[model samples]
Target: MAETILVTGATGTVGSELVRALINRGVNTRAAVHSIIKGDRLRHFNPEVQLVEVDYHRPASLPLAFTGVDRVFLLTPFSDQQLIINQQLVDAAKAAGVQQVVRLSAAGADMEPGIQLGRWHRQMEQYLEQSGLSHVILRPTSFMQNFVNYQGQSIREQGAIYLPLGEGRMSYIDAFDIAEVAAAILTDDVAKHHGQAYTLTGPQAVNHTEIAGIIGQATGRPVQYVDVPETAARQAMQGAPQWMVDSMMELNALGKAGHLAGTTPAVEQLTGRPPRSFQEFAQEHRHELMPA
Candidate 1:
């Protein structure tokens, strides 16, 4: 029988794609979602994907979620209790006889406290490292799908993309590529994979204005880029909590000053394919942005 790998945050961007890649390689995937309602789509996406209710906030669900699972992919919704939730996952993974674990962390996942996600993810990485399970930490840069969130309702009405990030360059990585890398690490046992973290980014660096230009051209619409102040950016975000506001602003400030603009071939090296360019991403989803 094939080993079963349990994936947390199964309905999320990377988790959704990660599950597919694992199943393609003949790995049995069990998706631990917060609720059965969210797991329906993942089950439809993969016949082999088994959905189970595993709420991280309530650590009680984790043991049941990890039952008979050999490998685990952990993802914490970045927030105040991230460290605590991650610790719970580590304990549960260890208790449930899990052998390998993969973590989806943010860029700059080091112990240093320069960035919020960095500090939190580093703590989680350290906990998993000493948890007696083989682990791979994926520190991916700014997600390109963050742009997709803007296209949802407000930006479609306003014909513009708003951000606190001015003309700062960043290698915005594709979430699918991140997932592909995560899937590879979870399945294989390369020496370099253990006790190591990989920083994943796109092939090239570009600014928010350039992203706007791509979106404008791709959709044949007049799209504008407006650099709002951090205060305004926070107010503009719908349903954004106070913590998310702080993190988003910090990331924007960091990117605007060119602090997160590292290009890498690691994604391609691990996945055996180049990360998707903004042009390709735009072309594939142009219809969604410009529905007539």
Candidate 2:
């Protein structure tokens, strides 16, 4: 019998793509979503999928979501409550007799005295390590999708990308590559990847200005990268929680320091293909980045 894999955060960016990847591999996939309504879209995409609403607020939902599941793909939302939420999921997975867990962590998660984002993810990694469950941690750098999710509006209206990154570059990975890596690990031998951590990244590093040029060349529009002051970036996020605002500023500081720069071979090692380049990402998302 084939193993049944449960994916938490199933409607999220990487989780949604993971569901598709798993389905493409003909794996038995159970998607644990917070909103059954949103999960209906997955059903439309593939009727063979099993959807279970897992409310972190409700303890009962966790067990039901893990029931009959052999392994789990864990991707938690970014927030102040991330550590606590991850603990809950880890405990639930432990009690459910799940064999392995593939955790979607952030790049630099293992850094000592790391920034807020890295510290939060590292804490979860430590917890998962202590849980005695087989696990694989994927620490992917800045996501290429952030261009569309966070800055697409600006690009659409003004043909510009704004950030406090300065000249710092990062090897931004496509969430599709992350999903494919996770699917490969989840379906392959657990003993091979057990307790392993992979730093997933794109084929190369590029700064915001270079990114702008790539998008412009791909879409046939002049897009410029505007390096705003850190204070201005903070002000732009005024509506967000104080913790989120502060953490984002910390990340911006890291980017400005060139700490997030570097390429890794983990994606290719696991997926058996080189990760997507920023140019490819820009071209594929041109519709979203182009002026409306």
lDDT of each: 0.83, 0.92
Candidate 1, residue 247: Cα displacement in angstroms equals 2.2
Q: Best-fitting candidate, measured by TM-score?
A: 2
Write model 1 residue lDDT over 208-235, tens digit each, in one string.
Answer: 7888889889988878888888777777
Q: So what's the TM-score on candidate 2?
A: 0.98
The residue-level lDDT of candidate 2 at 54 comes to: 88
TM-score of each: 0.94, 0.98
lDDT of 1 at 33: 88
Q: Given candidate 1, what's the lDDT at residue 274?
A: 94
**Candidate 2, 1-292: lDDT as tens digits:** 8999999989888999999999999999999988888798987658999999988778777888988899999988887778988999999999999999999999999998998889999999999999999999999998999999999899889999999999998889999999999999999999999989999999988999999999999889999999999889888998999989998899889888888898889988999999999999888889888776
Candidate 1, superposed: residue stretches over 4 Å from native: 190-192, 237-240
Model 1: weakest 10-residue lDDT segment is 149-158
- Worst lDDT 10-window in candidate 2: 37-46
